[model samples]
Target: MEQQQIKLVVLDMAGTTVADQHEVEACFAKAARMSGLEASDEAILAAQGLSKRYVFQLFWRAQLGESHPDVETQVDKSYAIFKEVLEAHYQTQPVFPTDGCLKLFSYLKQNNIKIALTTGFYRVVTDIILGRLGWLEGLDENRIGNDDSIIQASIASDEVEHGRPAPLMIQKAMRLLGVTDPKHVINAGDTPSDLQSGNAAGVLLNLGVTNGTHTVEQLIGHPHDALIGSIDEIINLIEGIKQGRPSGKTADAYSF
Candidate 1:
């Protein structure tokens, strides 16, 4: 197989690129409780990279049978509350970039590789975080690509037809970045859904970062090129991928 040069890199937001102190879980828990659902942290953690609306629907359907008339309404109600709580948490909280994330972003920019942020967050919440960080400058109204901007693209879960575990976000990013071949893309995140989407899209490499919401044990057995540490570890992996080196996996460390 011919190795295609990488053109775009798609990354998850909260736990992957942004420092998450389980604030998302705390907000989600508050919303779940107010809506009469006693969801555990493990459950919420497991659904880390999924759409919040979808997560509510899943839990509601699990509690109330799928055919029950109250499922959709409860999902809507729960999601509305989640958005309120989530928005407030992010608004008041200290939001910062994850370790080595800025350096990696600069590396990609200097190499002429497009950087896109895809998050399970809806657009409003996504903007709150980006606006605070001043990372929203280059995105168009639709959050599409702009080469002159620090980030070439910003994709919110609500912007796509489907969220993680589905390839739509990654595919949409590729389209906006003008990257037709998945072989020319790289996808990285801290959750299994992130890996699945990248694998589903047939990207050049799908990576997992343990320093996020999940641990190495939690991320193992997923179809990923390797499980790494910080976001910046990707710099070496990108070089290896571009040079036709298939970075292999190892235990507990950055195997890529």
Candidate 2:
């Protein structure tokens, strides 16, 4: 629980460190409509933090019931549309870091903690967003840079065999960062699957931010060490840990 014991912090992209205004969810709905998949927005939003392809697959199965002759085709079409829509949005729209995201990064860097971004997005779109925010500047080919780099590392859902609600992405981030112990990592995200993923990874701390896709009531249904309204509160938790306080260990809710 000590500050020095924390070696890395794994973050979710769209809703955690990036200000997502339901854009991704909206795109998913569009893709579903375009592909003739019957899915409600609530269903798509509930699947947030899950790999987009998997989301489509789930929806296709639900829509078609069991197996259908054209299930794969429909899923593929929806997924393709989703990728195109999301890619174009990030490529054309103005992108900015979430509130206090940069300051949290600075604080982590100053404390010698590694920062890694994990997302349900594919590598292509991930790069586009990172590039727009100028967070991909110093990253190397492996996408795993040092603390001095824009971000220590970035892991996309495609890079891992499984996405959120599974530990693969978090495990991949830890491996790439050269951090061996899950007990020394913290996972902070904005969705239920994010918390489930962190819990499956057995991280030292699993936190949630309510300012993103899900509300506090939704996030509390998942297992998390703490919940906050903004990323800026991370600084306060780290500072508390530095002072020998069991700050983030308590399952309290924080909203600003």
Runs of candidate 1 with Cα error greater than 4 angstroms are 247-256
Tens digits of per-residue lDDT for model 1, 1-256: 2555778889999999999988898899999999998688999999999999999999998999989998999999999999999999889988999999999999999999999999999999999999988899877897775767889989999998999999999999989878899988889999989989889999877888889999989888788877888889778777765566664223433443
For candidate 2, write residues 158-201 as lDDT tens digits: 99888889999999989888899897788899999999999999
Q: RMSD, each candidate, Å?
A: 2.0, 1.8
Q: Can you give the lDDT of residue 44 in candidate 2?
A: 86
RMSD of 1: 2.0
Q: What is the Cα-based lDDT of residue 60 in candidate 1?
A: 91
Each prediction's TM-score against the native?
Answer: 0.94, 0.95
